[model samples]
Target: MTQITFKQGWRQLISGLADLRLAIILLLSIALFSISGTIIEQGQSVSFYQNNYPEDPAILGFLSWKVILTLGLDHVYTTWWFVTLLVVFGSSLTACSFTRQLPTLKSARRWQYYKRPSQFEKLALSTELSYLTLDQLIPELKQHRYKIFQEGNQLYARKGIMGRIGPIVVHISMLIILVGAIWGAFTGFMAQEMVATGETFQVKNIFEAGKLSKAQIPQDWQVRVNDFWIDYTQEGEIDQFYSDLSVVDLKGNELKQETIHVNQPLRYDGVTFYQTDWGIAAVTVQINNSPIFRLPMAKLNQEGEGNLWGTWVPIKPDLSQGVSLLTRDLKGTLLVYDTAGKLTGVVRPGMGIEVEGITLKVQKLIGSTGLQIKADPGIPIVYTGFGLLMVGVVMSYVSHSQIWALKVDNSLYLGGKTNRAQVGFEQEFLAILTALEKQQPQLVTSSSEKG
Candidate 1:
């Protein structure tokens, strides 16, 4: 007996670990972590932490490598503690269902009638009418579309007992989703890159920085950016942004092309790409002389540089000196130099400064375009979980009921019960009993005969 007690205790402990309470607690914890991730800007640079929390001792202390390593907060969801919590919750649910729920379901499936007077007295809806016998009750319940069952001197009636499994099914679906999420987090990869319009590069890393260990790009996919465009409102607010993207197969042939926008993402080979952002970038500069085409010279340079200078010597014998030029702030300064490279006067854009012999003018400023690239592999699992969760919720809210009847000594007894959605079930039960009274010829006759 002691051994049996010990075993039972151990089983209960295991079952409790897998209970819905544990799953709820774990889910709440995950929610907290998600909230924390949102509130704390992720993927920020080290300098961002320095700038944002400079004097905050706690933040500064948490930013240290030791604390990050110990807490695994850098990659919260993937951390051992978080994963352990998920595993424990999942195990608890499975254990609870296996040890407790399965047996309960089995017993519910077995035929057992409610006959105890004390039980009947305890019920919220109980009626004792002399006219109703077990036989009449059974047929009436059958007419009402309830599954009927009988035991000696007792009647077990049920309808929609299948609804009892709704919570379990929902829980199982959640477990599947959790498993998928964990699998993706461990094996899946995500990475982002910024490309100028018409520029492309292979994704070489999985994470923004050191948040998670880097993962390799999958072998079958090669992504390229064909074009990026941003449409803006008349008031200068951004209206929409999109990227034209192409995917190449392993053989270097284009497999697919798609236009992806902010919310609408491009999916290929189990991966999805989203257009996250766009920026101005990679500008080049050019210099051309104005008014006369004598010395046409063009120079290319990166934007935002401090200085630009160029010189042009005339080919004509009559023109002995060359023009010296400098450009700043979209303006040009021109100076003339003697054949010997001597001191010259300055000139600005559209204005000629007398130098060794000529005048110069500024021509153009060009701009480059930039686009943001991103890919996530966990989306499919997340979406599948969402779909199943909705289904489970709907099933749980719809109750299943059954009614049974038995005849003994020319008297009828009726029994009925539902798995869930009790209020609606009760209302339906009442409606069915009322219909039986009005429709059944023998039902009223039996009641009067008994009276």
Candidate 2:
């Protein structure tokens, strides 16, 4: 007996470990850690921490290279502790659903037609009305949207009973989502590539900084950005930004073409790619020079000057001094100076300038373009989980109300109960009883009538 008791206690302990409350606490802890990871920028450079937090000892200590490496905070989501928390939470939810939810649902579905009026009287929200006959009360109960359960002198009626399953469904959905997320994190790879306009490049790795190795693209798949555009509001706020992309195979066969924007991504081959950002890049300009004409221009913009078109031209014959030519909105103007600290003339792009017997021309401009890339394999599962979660939440919150009616000799009794959403269920119950009394006046005794 003692051995059996020990075994039972152990089983109970194991069962308690898998409870819904434990799952909630585990989920909350994981959420807190995830929030912290986001707030503290994971996988950042050591210098970045040094610059951002020069004096804060806590940040300096925790964000050190050794600490990041030791604690796995550099990649918190994929870390062992984070994954363990998720797995534990998922197991708890699943256990709760199977162990607690199923039995509850079964009990809710069971027919309770033998409950006595004394049992109904014990309920907090029960209603007792003396009526003339069962015939009148039955119709009245049905009018209140209650399904009837009748046995002998007792009748049971229920409405919205399915609502009892909501919380269970919600828990199941959460489990599915967590499972999907875990599946994605372990099995999926993310890759990013920045391509300049009219240029194509293959993505080799995802930027995980120091933690994750570079990602690899499939040999059969290729991605190209056909174009990218950004529209800004009059107030300089971005209104819309999107990228036109084409997917192709190694044989150069086009597989698909799609436009992707923020919040709207493209999916193909079980992979989803998001359009995150775009930036300016690769600027170039051409200049023309001849023997009779000369132009000079700096590659970058001058100090304290806006990006204006300009060229430098040396004065004819002497050639020691030069004139600066400037253009605004295609209109040309000139400023003159010499090499000796004197003011130099501004010049427009494409204009020729002469200095020291040589002619110079403004040739070209160049700059960088930026692009943001992300690929997640688990989005489908996540979305499925979200759908399930919504359904479960709705089911859980809505009440399944049941009313019981019984008749013994000349007396009639009615009682109702709801699993949840009790306030609404009570209102419904009152309305049904009122309708029953109206239709069958004899069943509702004068003493039971409200003032």
Candidate 3:
């Protein structure tokens, strides 16, 4: 009695896990938390959340920066609970596929030869033809592309078996997607770099990185920005831009090179570099009586004009009086300011402006390119899952169909069934019956051929 009880309990547990309801609930839970991860920015600095989702103004009055930190909301995808959900979902798919889909497919494949003509009444469509034999009926069923199985005076046939396998394929593809997402969550990293032209830099400044993704990070190779330039329309608005980039080995050998722009990116090994933003890093100018000097420019935030850089050039030895050189863009005007905070003059590139009784020439501006880089190991698997999903969806539409025929005494019994597209299947089944009806004339056939 105890052994039977344990067996029944175990079967009940398996049934519960394999239930469609359980799978739906788990899927909904995963989607809800995934949405939360998107709404609350992930991998932001502590100070960032502290400002936006502060303790007092706490977003939604309950979710503060502290709560995000404590609950690991910043890295929801890689968190234990999230991964656990993925694992459980995958397991549910496996269990459901094994317990339900596979068995359903197996049942579809295994044919049952109708031992009695009365079985035809159990089908959705059945009838008795007055004058039909095995030879006349076989040809009509053959035209319909059904595989035939026969015993003496009995017939079974089926087609569109893909409809049975389609569900299994869909379940397997879903499992593949879940595994890919979990893999990416544990092994992907995102980093941002602001590099000046002609400068080489290694991958660092990781804004978001997986816990075990150190190996996937670019460590051996470096990136060099050969040149950076922008294209502008007649209205002086940016039309597009380009960044000439190269992947370099540690020993100074070139690996891959390309001219990347917006919507275009450079890929090396497993990492991808995207041109995301741009900035001005420094300016070159000629101070009075000083060799053409290059001074680092500090970017400023101004009203109505966004991209602006400024630098103070000392015209006096005491460094007391200097001109504030403010620039609008790399190729635009430079505003000169006196020590009294008055805009003295406007100077274009290669032009001179009088400041503190001396001519200060604006020479050129150097530009910096901002690049965002990322590497995800599971992208291929994810794409493969997507392909499988499309194939499975198409296969699902084929319509699993079945038919049965039995000969009792001098009459041929015919019936049909389908798992989907029943109206279409019915039309085809009726057409086959009509064809058989035309050939219903009696014919002689050997009973030994029934095998």
TM-score of each: 0.70, 0.74, 0.93
RMSD of 2: 6.4
Q: How close is candidate 1 to the true structure, as a TM-score?
A: 0.70
lDDT pick, better of 2 and 3? 3
For candidate 2, write residues 1-451 as lDDT tens digits. Answer: 9999999997786598667678778978998888867876565667765566454564646555456556766567778899999988877776777777888888889866645657656554655556455666677666666777666777777777668788787887887888777766665565556555555555565654223222323557777777776667898566877778888887767799888888888777766677765543332222234343323333346576744444455545466665454442212233334555465444444554554344545432221124444444566788998999998877776777776667766556666666666677767767766766676675634323221
Candidate with top lDDT is 3
lDDT winner, 1 or 2: 2
Window of ten residues with lowest summed lDDT in model 3: 442-451
Each candidate's root-mean-square deviation in Å? 8.4, 6.4, 4.1
Off by over 4 Å in 2: 1-10, 43-63, 115-117, 125-131, 209-216, 225-244, 258-368, 439-451
Query: What ordering of candidates by lDDT runs from best to worst?
Result: 3, 2, 1
Per-model CA lDDT versus the true structure: 0.58, 0.63, 0.85
Superposition TM-score, candidate 2 onto the true structure: 0.74
Looking at candidate 1, what is the lDDT of residue 374? 40
